[model samples]
Target: MTQQVPDKLVIAISSRALFDLDESHHIYETDGLAAYCAHQRAHESVPLAPGVAFPLVQKLLALNTPDPQRPRVEVILVSRNSADTGLRIFNSIRHSGLDIVRAAFTGGASSQRYLAAFGAHLFLSADAGDVRAAIDAGYAAATILPSSGQGEGAGGQLRIAFDGDAVLFSDVSERIYKQRGLAAFAANELAEAGTPLPGGPFKEFLAALHRIQADFPQDAAPLRTALITARSAPSHERAIRTLRAWNINIDEALFLGGMPKGPFLKAFGADIFFDDQQGHCDSARVHVATGHVPYGVANEAPASLPFSVVSQ
Candidate 1:
């Protein structure tokens, strides 16, 4: 069935990303697997509360239908929980009325291996290790951070926002900026403004989203996307050029030029924002659900680098 739906925009999400399982996770960490299983079994019938990515999942699933030919979205649950303990998650799914029918209950093993089989365009999880594995395996994956913000945009749209460098485009420019400072970075951008930047980890995912968007009338599309990057002026030109070359449409573009992204993302009513920098993710999550994309040069050898450099 999954093979039959190859054209669908499939998203693989972890159970913890879908539900508030903090207490249960803590129990597993402390009392071992048996206790965790016992607790889950004891509370199997009680529906779990929504987690950080819950609202986004809701919106994405709302765009789907039983028809496979038309543009549609499919959400597949990929969890480390064994099917026995995972009954609670399934119960919660039914309780929440999510139309999720495909899943992989991998016991305690990593679920990244199943992502390719399911043809997941994107994967979201709370585990940084799992996210990294998925990224290494070439899927658009992010560690969904805990957040306290409105789940949906005002118009009930799936307003997804992404960072430019490292997240969407390769960190080639970011590495230059980091090593040689802004002056050189600006010079490089000016010199190579015409060249399209290399595709980063999330490029394919963004393109898949664009494909889904192409199915609907422009003004009446069910989903929207924005590029919320720190680049400004000259650097912005290359990003614009790159998106044009890729033929993907980002509904909004905000070149904050290194300003903190919290207020802007809040204003945009972003349901979720993705950035490779932890500091930006930290700031954005205060106002919107944020995902930390731990990829590219920025994430390499982080300890040796200064806090300012890492956060910037």
Candidate 2:
């Protein structure tokens, strides 16, 4: 009989997202693949410092301790480096004691293609192109951003934050806001307040986390979730009602009403924050670990604004 893959919350992450590989990445971009390969080989014995997602991965792996046979989470390393060049990443993984045994080394090929093969619920990478491709392919993916400080893993709690429209729920409301402005958007939401919003990219991922959270006592569960959005009072009702209809419980919800999300996320001590808008992601990355979910109306090249500015 063959061994079965455990029913776990599967996450596929890039080497850069798992560890700080900016220096190595710079070499590859500037000096080409040969130099990057050589550099990795030369530094093969050196342990890597943790990147933004390190603490999140650490806490996620900790969920496995209660039951070795049926771990709650599974993390897979998916990278563009060839197997030879990947030895350093594996070495660092060993040094850091991360239980990431499964991996796919695509050489210089895009690693996003293998996400579904790994049965990943979420994929995080430093490469924006790969993240965009993954999202286009219908996978829950985000491009990891730089962090202002090290992640908070000392608390032993996994705190995940999500954006509302275009993230947790479909971009329908967002399309109205983008096309007709706030007042019309508000009116639309008000009229549809009772209707449940359709699920978006991160919906399945959140459901998986909820399942893991259910395994532990609510008062003492190691996982905590928050809905941090730009939506305010009148519009917020729809989001709340939608979550209620879906039977999902978010530990916290912040309707900032266009206020910057960075400060709030920092105060929440979020291990990881995901947002569809690059503006929010940029701001939050400076305070906490952030991921850019390039999706919906916000990510589209605006007719009035330049592409770069809209994305920034």
lDDT of each: 0.90, 0.89
Tens-digit lDDT track of model 2 for 146-240: 88854463378889999999999999988877767788889999999999999999998998988899999999889899999999989999999
* Model 1 agreement with the true structure over 1-312: per-residue lDDT tens digits: 444465788999999999999999999999999999999999999999999899999888877643445538889999999999999999999999998888999998999999888888999999999999998888899999989775357676788999999999999999887777788889999999999999999999899889888888998888899999999997899999999999999999999999999999999999899999898988998999999998987788967655555235
Worst 10-residue lDDT window, candidate 2:
303-312
Candidate 1 structure, TM-score to reference: 0.95
> CA shift at 89, candidate 1, in angstroms?
0.5
Q: Give all candidate RMSDs, comma-separated.
A: 2.1, 2.6
| CA deviation > 4 Å runs, candidate 1 | 1-3, 65-71, 303-311
Over all chains combined, what TM-score does candidate 2 have? 0.94
